[model samples]
Target chain A: MIAPLVIFDLLLALTIVALAVAVLCLRDLFAMIVVFIIFGLVSALAWVRLSAPDVALAEAAIGTGVTGALLLKTLHHLRYVTGRLGQNAARGLTAMAPVPVAVLLANAAFCGLITLGLAVAFLGAPAAGPGFEGLVAQAMPQSGVEHSVTAVLLNFRAYDTLMEVVVLLAAVIAVWQIERGLSEAPAPVMGVVWQGFARLALPVIVVVGTYLLWVGAEAPGGAFQGGAMLAAVGLLLLLTRAYVPQPGHRGLARGAFVLGTAAFCAGGPSGGQRGPRGL
Target chain B: MLEGFGAILIAMGAVFFVAGTVGLLRFPDIFCRLHALTKADGLGLALIALGVALLAGTAGAAFRVALVWFFVAIASATCSHLIARYARHGAGGVP
Candidate 1:
């Protein structure tokens, strides 16, 4: 008999695969987005089951929460644009041509072959090897952080982390630029219940974000998780129209966007100087 | 004994969750579905959180679990309300 834990794992994996198929097959944009979000949440659970709470938190916050909201926003924009065009245009967009059976079979066969190959490769690999865990543990004292993951991310591999932050900054800037071209029609005011909830929850969200950032030195939390939490707060504010940006708010917003990259860059040289291979 | 009790509570919570899912699938309309889901799942989650907290056996862990339950309750309530409102009135206003 299969162990209960193994059965749970199998079910979770099946659910993820089913969600992926549903997301692809669902023609309705809203339904597809919802399925994708469910996929993210299920994957997050899988991560937790694999004993990777850090990844689970990140997946839940960024992959499911923020990305799902963004997709919904995109759908709203698409509807607006399509509505402006005509009903015919919207219908044309939705009425995509069905894929041929032969192509579908070919794709499935290819995917199966790839999966088989990966399974073989994984099975053929050595059961044990000198992995980075030992090296990380050896260097942990020098890294100055209790959490090995954070130590590796922020100290040993600071350059990679810095580059990631820079990329995020660039993406934010790009999005801002694109958004500037869009119509500045005021967002509809949410109901009083939502407004009240947002007001009550915003401060709590900030506190949680700060806690996540602080806990990274010793636990499964970090800048990415914290930033995603803050982003959720921003989404809430925008949804409620409680923190609408004026022309004067642009400077402050830009500064906040650049702060992470700036701090990383400033810290990089100092950290490098303390290392054995000083740059 | 506490662990066993916690396990039982968790099992009960799972039953409620199953009930909620069934209601979600079988309910006639969006509002009805939302009604079934929010009420059932909120209580289900609270029970689950309580079970986990009891299993944890630490004040700090229980507090954290309670905080998670609080946040999830707020989010679920607010989301259900918004969805029901949207279904009833549409995006712009009452049609």
Candidate 2:
């Protein structure tokens, strides 16, 4: 019953704790980035266990997906810099840090925080939100969606969703403008197999994205979910340089980004007053 | 029964992650270590996420967990590709 689920959750939490340790302890920058991606996935799982689907979706999409891409790109650029600057300096710096002492301090701090947090959560629970609960429960029965979290998000707190869209739009705009001055694009030097695999995978991702969007109204998926899927396609193309921006492509990308931002700005505040008819 | 299976998968995933970490630390070279991190780590995470998704009572919860798996797959593969590209360009080594 709930006992086993509790154990599963505990195990997941422990695994994540260990994974985070692994992420921090790895010395190689590439290995470190890989560990980070794993940590993001595990944490998203933890969010799911805690009953927050929207948060999980956001964590997976932005946290792992976009953020990981950014890190990987940065790592590549940094490695180039490090390589040209000479590995001797990097190795010397790494050797200077007393590894054992660092680990000991980090472990002590981590364990202390976890123990304190668990103790607080275990004893004397916080007060429940009566009004929010009423709103969630009331809106749950009437909303077309079956999932309570979905109803709460799409109905009760749609404003948040709107705001997220706005933020995302803003981010894309900022990145687009920053890259506008660059005359040359970075080309991906992947082998032929990667090219073929990406070609094969693109259609599948497109289908999955469409399916997620269509099912989102009733299930856990949605436009954000679908867009992430589409973004993955774009990301893959970007990675492979297959979809690298030509003159026309750059303009289209900028326009599409602006459209998304405008949509988000208009849609977000509109939904705030829709649910309970209150400020 | 489902939950039991999930527990097993989760354990297996953790083991794979540990193995990947060890491989990354001990391997003689970057390419081999990347192999361990990419294949084993991706499979490990997908398994663990799948297990959690199976245990979810509601569709929304399951979808969310599954989304994490998908993201991990996307992020890890993409990042690994970039890392490999960087390394092949002679970014790091004793030389």
Candidate 3:
């Protein structure tokens, strides 16, 4: 409503529109990837604006950070392969007359349907079941946890969080196996600077991660948050080739990856089902 | 008073996000595009998270949102690394 804020919002909106247009118009595949990374960041910002910090965080980490990296790598590989072997190339020939128009029409129809469905869903906000607000309030008053969501995630829905951890571990294992199947050993890049920094940073990161996990019972943190931090360390290690991920190297990575799930699963049945805590 | 600031922060974040996207689209080369995305996403999310944290009266709510913020950062960074590696190794780009 203020003039400056309104101006800011308009600018943001314009930028998003411009980027989308540019991404669609760009001829180069690499340019498209770059556009997508920008899109991820913009979306994260949008999430924050919408009063969802958690979503924003996830968007930043998973969307822009991880997904952008993945896309860029893929594009780079494609470019390299194309340059060397010239294997994959888009054909310049159109099979039939008016094919472009027909293709456009089909895409338009698909977009229309998706847009309509999303709009309709967003417009509807039916009354939910027994509200968690009441429960959360009660729990807060009695429980030791300072964070409501942390309480919900760890105490109420501990089992779900646990399983989620397992899923992450499974995914990491799959990635490792895929690379291993290709006969790629953990090619550890050697450098005193890289190794030294990693050695220093790893311990600090680990300590922070552990603090997050341990404080979850009564703080604004938990396993999911902690696990992600821990995973980041592995990711960093992998990046510099500090800790080479070999074919069977499944000790710390494996444990950290699955710790949340293991904890959750172990808590369930043994602690008796109290409420809903599914991931 | 705080509510007004929250609104301002949120709006500013959105602008950055859009700016990042535009940069990404306009930038030539994979690395340059990545730069746009990382900068935009990190700032945007932080602003949004800050707003949310302010709105959250309880510590738990704030924590939950913060957790999301933390995870998003980790995930995004990791993905970027993967993409870079794929390009370098699979495509034979410089490591």
Off by over 4 Å in 2: A1-7, A21-27, A81-133, A141-144, A183-186, A264-279, B1-95
lDDT of 3 by residue, A1-279 (tens): 578966766777787788889877776666677897898788777766666665665576556655666666455444443343243432212222355888999999999999999988767745565757887988785555677766676567765766655666566667766654432333433334445556756776678667666665664445544555565676666656655656465565455445545555676412211111111
**Best of the candidates, DockQ:** 1
Per-residue lDDT of model 2, residues A1-279, tens digit only: 578988998899999999988987877766777788988888999988887776787678767876687788665554443353246434422433456988989999999999999999868576663646666777676776766655665556676776665566566666666655542534546565467668868887889777765576676766665677677777776777775557766676556665655654565322211110000
* TM-score of the A chain in model 2: 0.71
Q: Tell me which of candidates 2 and 3 scores higher on lDDT.
A: 2
Candidate 3 residue spans exceeding 4 A from truth:
A1-3, A13-29, A73-114, A126-135, A142-144, A159-163, A169-200, A211-221, A250-260, A267-279, B1-95
* Error at A203, model 3, angstroms: 3.5
DockQ of each: 0.49, 0.11, 0.09
Show how many residue pairs clash in every candidate, following the order shown: 0, 1, 27
Candidate 1, residue A184: lDDT: 56
Could you tell me the TM-score of candidate 3?
Answer: 0.55
Per-candidate RMSD vs. true structure?
5.5, 8.5, 9.1
DockQ of candidate 1 relative to the true structure: 0.49
lDDT of 1: 0.79
Ten contiguous residues minimizing lDDT sum, candidate 2 chain A: A270-279
Q: What local lDDT score does residue B16 receive in model 1, on the 0 to 100 scale?
A: 89
